[model samples]
Target: MNDAHHRDADAPLRMTDAQHREMRNAQHRETQRAVSGFRGDIEGLRGLAVLLVLVFHAGVPAVSGGFVGVDVFFVISGFLITGLIVREVRTTGRLSLARFYARRARRLLPAAAVVLAAVAALTVAALPPIRWSGVAGDLAASALYAVNWRLADQAVDYMASEQASSPVQHFWSLAVEEQFYLVWPLVLLALVWWHRRTGWSLDRTLLAGLAIVALPSLVWSVSLTQVEPGRAYFVSTTRAWELAIGAALAIGAVRLSRLPRAAMVWAGWLGVFAIVVAALAYGSSTLFPGYAALLPTVGAALVIMAGLAGRGRNAAGTGGAAGYGRGVGRFLSVAPMRAVGALSYSLYLWHWPLLVAAEAAWGALSVVEGILVVSLSFVPAWLTYRLVESPVRRSGRLVAVPRRALLMGAACTAAGVAGAVVVHAAVPPPPQVTASAGSRPATQALAETSKRPTAKPPPQDEPTSITLDPLKAREDKGPIYRPQCHQDQPSAELQFCAYGDLGSDKVMVLAGDSHAAQWQPALAAIATRHGWRLETYTKSACGFFDVEVGVGEPAVPYPACTAWNAKLLQRLTGPDRPDLVVTSSDTNYQVVRGGSILDPQASRPAYVSGLRRSWQAVRAAGVPLVVIRNTPRVNIDVPDCLSAHPRDLAACAVPRERAMAMSTDDQIRAAEGLAGVDLVDLTDDVCPAPRCAPVIGTMIVWRDAHHITATYARSLAPRLDRAMAQAIGGRTSSTAE
Candidate 1:
């Protein structure tokens, strides 16, 4: 392996055989040609794709679908790889599928393994202990190019935020491409052999591929987009058609030479515009690849088509319309774009996490700020390209002695797998057991009876029952219970949320996800206030999606949540409905809705359709739905803010305008329409005046980048008091009845 591939301290050089293998693997590395037709333009297009992805990710309002740059890259890869393999088949008569894949493994496995190892280490250090377990599992899945399945399993949780923002998220695209590389080559080889053996020429062989393989893939792409947009967006099987589109272009390049230079320019420009526009306009709502995705995919196809070929005579081979396509071809041929294209693999690998890390290191970077960080991220990419990517890729050592590179590649892959094992071993989750036939935990749980407890609301003596009436006179007993009772805070304000002295008369129901669990302290205060008890029915990601109360975690239903919900549902219908369902999830849960961010819609229809089913389950259980419209979903990450600003509250506050921007008045108003449901007025409660602070009354209310900190939920007692008291109905009068 060239001097660059030598193992560094982070990557220990163990076996000499492995090192020799690493060096030798370089020969099989298939190098992409420097802009074959209009090299400059393709480089420009690659830059355009990368830029679109960058701006889109940086919260640029315009480039919503810019992320599809990855798909664009996929298509480009397909075209390029197809051309290479077909050329080999034509020249050599027999295509070596093993050699093609080995080259791919050599090219991809090293950098990917290195990056995966880094991400794994960072994940273990940064992610919560509980999260490391899955992070570990994901690591292993990613190594095998099956991470898409892991993500799909997690996505079943309607409330799961696309925490795919994990350092490893980019790996999904790699996985898709890797999977495609594995199968497409063999399929082509088989076809090429059959046709050539029968004396067919290259043109006819390619046409057959276009007719049989590429065409079917394109058709499936459209169909998959409709039925399973999310899967279609991420899954390789669904995305293969896009690559095939490019592959077809490569196969037919010779035929496209007749196009005018002017037309080529227009087509190429239009392709750029399409990708740019799609990136800028697509947002959390676009159904993706369904029909909407056609914009960028076709735009990319046009670029490939523009470069397809040109008759070099009058227009050369660029055709009559080759104006700037040739010029674009020339411009992209410039040194910078080509260099970037040369190192595009490394640049793509390192850019995201580096930018993300920068964003994390110092709050969200502005447009200019993001640009600077992106510029800086290239340093590492350049260094790696110069040090690792270049030498190893060009080296013929691997071709001379195949075992060295093979073993080295295996070791690199093993490191990733081993890291995955470490994450798993360090923090193991419950043992995995397959779910019963075809029944998803969410689906089965959603279908189960809605449990409304018949138990009376927790006794009035409970602190969760104390009333807070802004309109009422002040009582010196200070609302009966103290906020921050969970921990010592000499000055922390105290307020009551639950009331009534219960001798098995009332039940204090805690609902929602981990946000609800954080209030164990506050809930305990109320339970302690009354001669009552505390019960647990917690689900980690069950964000009150009534039907799928607990989902996507274990194949087995969350028996605990169901058991408690049943009891709670009985009480509500019979006489017990939660004096208060102290739920804390934002009604607007976010999801990766097909390469775009999607927030829950608040319109009556959106709400009714999205939530009524769950609400019905709740109401049917005979309990009043004490709906807690989610706490302010702060775009300003809380932990990040804390680390950035310790004592100065000003730094931690989300600016007034921005805070107002996130508030969903429509959602709250809709919840208010439910007379039986007590809407906890949080819009006003969470934000006092100038702004909503990430930490209020010294309680770090906002948690992580998205959720509220558990410590912060304890401080909401005062805000919850009046509404909770009404729900509990005056049971919280004494500490001991």
Candidate 2:
């Protein structure tokens, strides 16, 4: 163990036990050869990779492929860590798991904890109460090095994906790296033990074992990227192969040392070109960490291998290429590249949160804003690298005592958790306001509301001060939510629930996305009054339009949504068709026609055409359809906006024109002239004129940017009920009353 620390790069192994000396000595020399062959160019690669990721995240154009930098990082980590483990095992004759993990913790935790604490403080100062829960959750996950899985779950979740990015979202890559650090040592230890017991070549044994691990992981990655790309992007199972690629190179370092100088030079430059091209050309449309990842990972491997070949002992054969080494290594070892590389880890951690905070405080970061934010991150990154990461990592006392290192890690984790708790506690809860029946009469509310009024409407006076709570607004979902009858975006199965009088013969079926689900409270109120059986079939982000939907930024086809729609349409037009099929959707999609995508404006015609098709199916089933126009979509999360700027509720109000522009105007136009389709627009009740206020009738108007609060939705029951009655021509029992 002592020899493991003090041995020179070219030193031969010192053996104590005579029986194992030859085997151990040979192994040690091989490790020394690999370590002695280190090059500064690798650190330059780190600088380049980190810069690409930082700029890409900062929204730099033409760097859409910058995300591939993470693949480069995975390869680097695998190579360095694998080399260290092999060296230690060769010298000490045993793997010290405790020392390995403790070293990793010491190297990574202190700076991370400081950054997490800072982010927490910043979040409390700038972000709204509604965002605290998510940020807190991310902080905890980051502390535990499980943020990758947490983010994977969130990526597939409809509500979570819509949320603003958390300051610590960048921790997911670190989490993946940390998880590998934990498991890889154990695997290496096992392989060493097997090699000794079976008398097999160490490199050959490791190569076979890693191949077993990497191949299956690569297969899973390829398939999942096609199936659930969002989750696959973060999950460790899909990313294990990239790390394996680097480990394989480390095992073959002995052979890599023999490449010619010219070959090394060409390969090194080609590797840099591959990474640069990937960063410049790739965009959000690319399915990554799959086959596409090979370009960057292979490029990174080539660079590392070339660097190794240039430094090996043989000027001709045993390994040595000073001219090739000087060409790449000298350039990379320059002051600026070396300095950026030294601060890369801390910079990667700090840059993302600052960008997120900047965006959250204002709106999207302009190119100039992004540039300034990236520049400012260097200050903290340098400070953290010097003040926190350096001192603790180099401390001999902590390095010698594995237990002490672990204790320090525990302390850092505790600090991160405490920071998260403090941030979470700062968020104010929703105000408790009991609805008073006499405050606003159900009958007179509609009479006072004018149709198509152009002036800014007054807020409802049901209980003005306690209109909505930011915390509760998120939880204030409809009846269909509790039982999960309203399926999430990823679910393909059709789920149905009866909310009203189940025994009643007069059935009303409600269907669409969460926007349609939001109206359930109001519809249920009407259903109970008239003893009508209300059947709800809703899916998140799955609108009723008979068109393909996209999931993320580049708009990948949502297979689950397509499957759900097919199943739902079959059920809706089957023998159990209701007396009236009521549908509403927050239409947020670009139209897909004959495999070509049309933008939001051009897609209106296609949206209307899809609606006509649905109307025809329902009409053919001998059922009347009442289409509820979707409510206004505010530009910001009303609850969050109100919470952040509580003293100025007026600031939370969006102009009615802007809000209406976000509505399903295309779908409404499509419904025109269709037989058996009755359009019931209640936009006036929800928005009521020139502007849409955050609060109505002492109830919060919106839960998020798009969905309305259940309390507010219930408040609109009287108006919605009236519209349904008029649209159905008083067909139900309660209409005449």
Candidate 3:
């Protein structure tokens, strides 16, 4: 029965049952060692990270720096995963890719799948239908470990920026880690193969390979953070260096473990200080994962390195596998830290959804309420850790059999996808309401409604909540959007999209930012009805001002807008000039001068000067100009807020004074002395005297916070047409025909 003896029949081969049992026992011990040589210190680090993130989410101002805990986590993950791979390669002389991946599957996928499913189901029930589709897509991406890239794509997307946060947004980090897990092993396998063929030591080879990968990634991180900080925050390339720092430590683990006790103690304490300080000093404006990230990542690296110093039998003259009882290692090995660390994964998974759900249900939370929600997160975290994470992770049968583990992982993935599909299917679409037969003419309706005694419109006059039709409300964009006529800030070329009678000589040009674009529906209606040509030239985030302004995150100078405006000015004054030119802008951006940002107070005069210059040029060309005041800004998303407060739709209205305060009053002053420019104020039409209501005469007034919905815009056609005819001083020769 002894295959070794049978193969070499010439040798007298005899083995006792005791020898066989001993050999089998040794293998079993090695497997157990590989799977369960628990690192209490590492668990404590995990505990620290989760605690930081949880407190930060709890809205504790002191822990503003707590977001850096994610960077710390990247370091810890890299160190531990690389250490395991190095150990296996050193002992077995080759890597077991199947077993390594199977272990990762059991440890990460099961609990993650549970959270994804729960998020999808809860999102459908609790959140607005507007967010459901996004949440569903995020769920599928999270399940497949690709949400980070998806989020990165969305981050720079101007339209999606206004969307509310997804419940599973935290999974972006997990996706990055999962991506590393998939790629790192193959890299390690190649290193091990090269070690077998060539004479290079495995540790040196790994260190060199990690350096090769980490250095360029670090360079890319710094470069991208400078230009596109928003997208850089979520992308994996920006975070790879953080992981590589830990991998490098794992490669030199034995060498690092031999440092002096005193040195380790200082390093550990200093690292903890660095981490806390970085968290405190940093804020939303801090360009992350760039040089700024070095503070936390290096701090985490020090803490991890210091924790290993003079420990684990790797120290010179140390005997056995006993670890040293000195430095931060002793501090981190404490039971409380280990206990929390044990549940860290589940805690992290549960906390974000709870916070998002709390915010969705009850606007912003008080400090005390936030603390309570974070504390309540512990309950589910404990349950998941004990019932799901611990049981499956500890089962030897699961770890010992790669096939079963993979199948289990596959099943969990399938369940997550199925849950998302079911949630999407279960949620019904918004009801479509036809135009009411009793709908009044927009101008006459406003005139009659203004005569009513009370500021609040009566229930009979109130519009049904078109906000409930969330999808329709979001799609209620102007005609310029569908034709891609709205130019973004990056483009200088003029995009001319005409609406209504293009053959008519009575031409009306609409130009400005998205605020101006919102009027296209009404402009088109008037142009078509009166046989006038309506031309549109609008851009997102860019206004009509000729002055330089800082916009977007980090307040970058908008040179494109300046360039586009100059070209527009020239075209408007040329022989091809329209009979009438209309313009409006958000006017929210700060003016940029000599690379310095000027506040609104200082910038208003500059903005006025810019407006005065542009208007003068247009008037010189014999073209009359109409300047419509920017629309009132209701700081909250009207649709989402109305959806939440369905019964009392009036709850979504803002006081007229407060709503009107958002527009720059300086714009009115800028137009006062200008010749041949007529000013039309329709804000009272949209948001009457005392309050700016979300719904005005059966049409939603605003989409998101600032721009008026197309429905509302279209309803204003009759009033706008009258105003346009006056501004142009009667119809032109083309409209006379």
Candidate 4:
């Protein structure tokens, strides 16, 4: 909704009767102009933007680039808000920040507050208990309009990345918009003040100010997206330029209006064409809000500029230029389009939470089911718009007094936050399960190979208790998961940690990506028991191989992984090479060959070759190598599954064959002819034979979908030790300890 035109309330006290009448007439004319100037085309654009986002989130394959719809919204917001501020400044010769912010709060906060509280209630009713605390945190962030920063931090966080998406994650865009609203007015006010002092035209000053803000943001967006795409996608800095584009268009609207009618009509259709093409062409792999965002943002600007040119009334007394009225503007001004546009904001707020809740209750939805769920959200969206948004926005009591509206906004914000706190408090704490006194250390049990039990079918009954609480299982990572030890995706720096008997002469090194890091607890236990020093060289998602690989969704080339792998190989083949090196990796890594990422199946041969090349280098240096076959991946969040099926834990188990099939035998193939290289297959222990249990023995097996819990890994120390001893041809004297 546009801001209401408010004249100075105290002006009449100082004015003569004749002057007061003149002032009232002028104010009435301005108000009438503002009301008549409402762009039906802009309303239709809002409808189109929300529709694109809805279909995109619903997983419609046809609108792969529908995400550009958000860019369109950003541009429209910039144009409308900037125009409001500039118009108020020009007419009154001053701006009231208090009134401006109060209007914004009244327009936005009520509907948002209603949605956040609804999400909290939905979390309690539909989502698994394990997800409550995380959703509560998300709710708190959304309530404060800081969820975008929260989501940005989580995007690059290894642990948080594995967690399910928050229902309020969609609030990230709202957070960005609110942040802009908070800062943009002050910026424009400062520029107007400067224009008055410097004797510069207001248009020139505003345009210069927009350029100053937008240029650097555009550069940062492009640069950051190349290196840190995950974080770049959510952060505010990368998105500010899009809003500035609209502000620039608004500032130049008068100049645009003087353009020929034919030119404006062509520009309008071209803008529509650009948006449709982007919606059809863009996909997940497209680096976003960077250079790619220019298409939609500029397109939105052109459309708005076209609307300005068409503002003149035709002979029929209908709005818009005669030529523009017959073109794209007519289609956008239809009754159905305007209705959708009117409800767009509320629809945007309601659709995502419903979709997320539905998916949480019933696995991933088919395209038809997703569309149905999104369709169902319209009921809530319309209700919220009719009952909450319209009522608060048009409240006469709040409109007359800005302070009252601000206070009401504060109360709504507090209510949303309080709801989150209550939900968080309602989550049950992790349960405690103590180990039996009779059990021997896993290292000791596996060392006595002859007495080791044969693999058996997974049990039909769920265990009454597990060693670690399933709710907190994702935090059960080994030392290698630490930020200082394992490098993140964007860095090529070589960082390693020392564990086990650090001063021992015999050195054992653990190497590879997170898959290799998952075995650190077992290896550390074995190293200490055998009096060997253990050093680890691991990176998140980076494999210890000779070939380059890809990371993130849609799989871009990971230069950091390649550089780190090269540095690691140099250390292994150098004069101070360890006595033995143990390596493992997730075989699903896509190979980056000839500047293109190969599909998983196509990448397999390249991975096998890379493994052999690296192993040969280690062997040529006279260092023995042991390859831990990649562990089984359950292909679902084990903790989430277990928490959802706590009473029937067996329901979370995956068939042994399916779980084992997750790993390719690339390591075994690589070690086939290499004399000093040995392969250890732990699939039998981790999965048993008939099925893979989410909880094996007393401990939860998998921390997430693929990685094993540190608690479970420690339990396998004895088996790892025995296997290492046999592979190396004999047990050392320290093994008997």
Tell me the whole-model lDDT of each prediction, alpha carbons only. 0.56, 0.79, 0.78, 0.82
Model 2: per-residue Cα lDDT over 268-334, one tens digit each = 7888889889999888778776788889999999888877663446432222133345445445555
Q: What is the C-alpha lDDT profile of model 4 across 224-320, one tens digit per residue?
A: 8776677888999999999998888777665555567778888888898888888989998887767888998888887877777734332212433
Q: Sort by lDDT, best first.
A: 4, 2, 3, 1
What TM value does model 2 have? 0.89
Instruction: Name the better of 3 and 4 by TM-score.
Output: 4
Candidate 3 C-alpha lDDT tens digits along 1-737: 58976767744333556577568646533442433245666777888888998988888888877889999999999999998887777667678888898899999989998888889867876786667777888888888889999998887776677778889999999999999999999998887777767878767788878888999999999988765677888999999999999999888876676678688888977887888899888876577778989998998898887766755443222211134355565676677888888889999999999888888988888878888998999998999988999899888899889989989999988887877787667666664434456755343344454534333333222344342564667678976886569886568788879989989988889988888899999889888988889999888777777788875565556777888888888778887888789888887878888977687789888888887788888888888888888888888887777666554556777766788898867678878888888887787777774666776656667788888899878877777777767766765322321
In Å, residue 611's CA in model 1 sits off its true spot by 9.5
Sliding window of 10 residues with minimal summed lDDT for model 3: 313-322
Model 4 spans with C-alpha error above 4 angstroms: 1-36, 312-324, 431-461, 465-468, 731-737
**Per-residue accuracy of model 1 over 604-639 as CA lDDT, tens digit each:** 244334344445566666555565555555675454
Score every model by TM-score: 0.63, 0.89, 0.86, 0.90
TM-score of 4: 0.90
Best by lDDT: 4
How high a TM-score does candidate 3 get? 0.86
Off by over 4 Å in 3: 1-38, 195-198, 312-326, 431-468, 489-492, 573-577, 596-623, 731-737
Worst 10 residues of 2 by lDDT: 315-324
